[model samples]
Target: MNAPIIIGAGVAGLAAALAAAPRPVRLLTAGTLDAGAASLWAQGGIAAAIGADDSIDLHIADTLAAGDGLCDAAAVSRIITGGPLVIDSLRAHGVRFDAGLGLEAAHARRRISHVKDATGHAVTTALAAAVRAAPHVTIIEHARAVALDVAENRVRGLWAETAGGLVHLPAAAVLIATGGVGALWRHTSTPPGADGTGLALAARAGAVLRDLEFVQFHPTGLDSGATPMPLISEAVRGEGAILTDETGHRFTDELAPRDEVARAIVRHLAEGHRVRLDATHLGAGFAARFPTIDAACRAAGIDPARQPIPVRPVAHYHMGGIAVDARGRASVDGLYAAGEAACTGLHGANRLASNSLLEAFVTGTDAGTALAGEPDAAATTAPAAPPRRI
Candidate 1:
């Protein structure tokens, strides 16, 4: 039998491949091996429960609260407790983290881990490098899985449309880590490739899906006219930024849950009031801290230090996808999912800010480990391509 296939190359996909180590797997990527993933665009730091004043239970409580009681309690506890270990795993893969754990809105303590404003870039680049160096992984780029070939409800293989052409690869198991559906929206922070491919693939394979409508719009996406709006990470507000209107008067609580804050912005905008994020008080420290955001603002011809950055709501995260269990196993056998593509009942109705990266890491690692423990690929049928068209 051929190796199991892992689709997507974000942090979750990379983490899954690394955890499946010593057991080879085939990985498919839709773009550049290192940069094209939406993970590279994530601005906020990851959340972990390792801060001096924090505890796993507190983290769980905050996640549950943000999720608005829709989260699975056990899942919340399990994943949140594993965050520190995820941090350790990233470091083990040569992902260097910058100074300071951050505090995101809705969290009672400073439990977010970071490599400054570009956490995603640092973590993704490092993990991709580690995977490239690993002997157990084979990466095929610019390839998108179009369909899963399932027989009798078990996934036998998948057909992908690549730069070369259509090809099929048989495997004993397949894991979907294809990220989110944010790009499906008119204004979003997800890459164009994040058009719900994993959810589609999983659903096509007869995998159960849930909560397909729980999209969380971020409150402070830079109100630029870019196609996919540049995100103003929650960390900015968690630090000291404030939300103000045209009159420069504070309106809603800046650190409220993402949905609430976004709703406030949307309502304010609907009423014809312009909203802005006042990071001006942060001064030059803003540039040194959020270089990516600062640069984007500057490119928009506005200095964050001198102006209250123009802001609005933009779809940032999906709190739904293929339904899966604790080990990231989907309802179907021989199939698994992690990251934004899989709804493991953690995020619930609204995702706690910065919890996405943490979920991606924990679930990916869990899924990979489970895959490694499964029956060896050699015990399965050989690769079989779909029938050719006339």
Candidate 2:
């Protein structure tokens, strides 16, 4: 067997590479670190069972309920149980989660790991830096994987296009962590580059793509024409930010789960009523706590100190992808997936407030440990001939 090919250098891809440590692993990305990924843009933190009041069972239930009807109970249970361990591993890798705040968001207890509000950026950046330093890992940026090649019912390799031309790299195992399918929508908070490429590739290889219709719409994408629309953290509501219609009438409680809040905001828009994030209560202190939101509101010419930040739900995440077992292995042998691109039933219908990163950590290591038991091998060079363009 050759080194496993891990696609997408987002948090999940980085985790997969790290998990496949000591084994020659090639981690590939469609763009630069944090460039085409929603992982970096995540304003909230990772969900965990680190709090005394919050048990793993509770977190698992919330995830399944949010996942709507498509969640796998066993898979969700596995991720919740392993959540804290994954966070600890990332912390060991130098990812700084927000601490000493008592409690951050969503969790009934203080279980969230944050690095200020830019928690996703903190985690992804830390993982990418660590991956760069790992001698066993190889990162190939500016390479777009167009498809997965499967022969004998197993993933064989990937077809990628680079500045030089198309390159086909065969692997002993393939891990698809290419993030979500947010770009499929007309308006989205996702990076334009993460347009279901991994899902497409896996499906092309005869992998099952479930829950394609269940897209999670975030309640607060800054309603400006900013490239890669800025996300107003859900923590805002947890911190007393209220949602109101155009006439200053409160429509829905901000503390509700994301799906409810997003649906309410969408309803208001449909009824010709605009909604906004009211942060005036915090006064000047609000800007200091959520600098990212403050800056985004300021750039859009809205004053969080004085007025509400305009917002609308945009496709922010997908609760679906290449289906995987609790160990993050895909349907195909020697193939695994983690993070947003791999659906391990952690997110049944809708993802919990900050479980995406947690799942990446847990599943990433699970896939890694599973692969580590296998024998190592020489690096397999890509095929000399390229497939015809699509």
Candidate 3:
């Protein structure tokens, strides 16, 4: 019997593979395991209610507040409650986070667990290593899933375009972990291949997409003319950096919600003012705390420790996607999704900083565990009506 097919190699995909355990799994990626995955570029850490002053209720309330009243209450409760377990799972896999939690924007308490400033890179690297060593997981790099194979309202498998040629692979179930659609926009902080291919594939397979318009634009993307602009970590602002216009006058509050901050930056640019993130007040501690941002700024010929970094709003995340249940089951049978590719309604219209990683871990685990329990080649069944689009 064929193994379950999992597409994309981001944090969610790798987590799904590991969660499947003894069940054989085929992990597919458009590029090398870490190359095109946006999870590798995340500078902010994962949000978990692990602080002495933090509680699950506070985390859930913060998430719902950031989501702008469109979040799924039950879904928010589930993922936020599972956060500490996710952290422990990562640590058991050899991913080490900073000794204590750091705060990010919109959170009422300090609850972000990190690895310096490059938390995503550290987590993905460790998870990828575990996936590589798993006996039941087979990784297929440079394989882009072009379309799903659906028959009689059920997903049969998928066709992937590989370097060798196009190939059709069979599966008992298919899980889409393809990151997000940020790359579809002009200015973004995502990899080039994050063009909503997974959403398209799911839609083609009769999966319902929800909240397609709720794209989250990150404020303070470095305006260095890079294809996918480098992001200035929000943690920088949480640590006391301020936003100033070209005239050196402080404007919008740096710690506002992402959507508000992004729109304010856009407004500033419309008024012919160049918005800058002034982190010079952070002094030398800036480099020690945010080595990734420091290195990126230096690469763009700007020293963040000495000068303010020019910034702009850029597409960063999709708060909507292929609609799914808390267990990550899509509308179609034998089809599932997790991570940024799947809209479990945990994020709603806007995403809280660092919650993306949390959702990815929780939903990916649920999807993989559910698939592992299914029969290897069970007959497909028609799904009920798809979820309503917001």
> Which residue pairs collide in model 2, if any?
66-350, 67-348, 67-349, 67-350, 68-349, 97-114, 98-114
Query: On residues 1-390, what C-alpha lDDT tens digit does candidate 2 reach at each position?
Result: 366788887788888788777888888888887576668887778788877677887777677766666777888787788877877887898887666432433456666667778888888888889888999998889988887766667766778889988877777778888888888876688888668888877776777777776788889988887756788888777678888877899998776778888888898899999888898998897787788889888988988989988899888898888888877777776777788888777677777788888887777778766766654433545555534332
lDDT of 1 by residue, 179-198 (tens): 99999888888899888989
Q: Which run of 10 residues does model 3 get worst, by summed lDDT?
A: 381-390
Comparison by lDDT, 1 against 3, better one: 3
TM per candidate comes to: 0.96, 0.93, 0.96
- The candidate, 2 or 3, that scores higher on lDDT is 3
State each model's CA lDDT, in order: 0.87, 0.78, 0.89
Residue 45 lDDT, candidate 1, scale 0-100: 87
Candidate 2 lDDT at 306 equals 90
How close to the true structure is residue 182 of candidate 1, measured as C-alpha lDDT?
A: 90
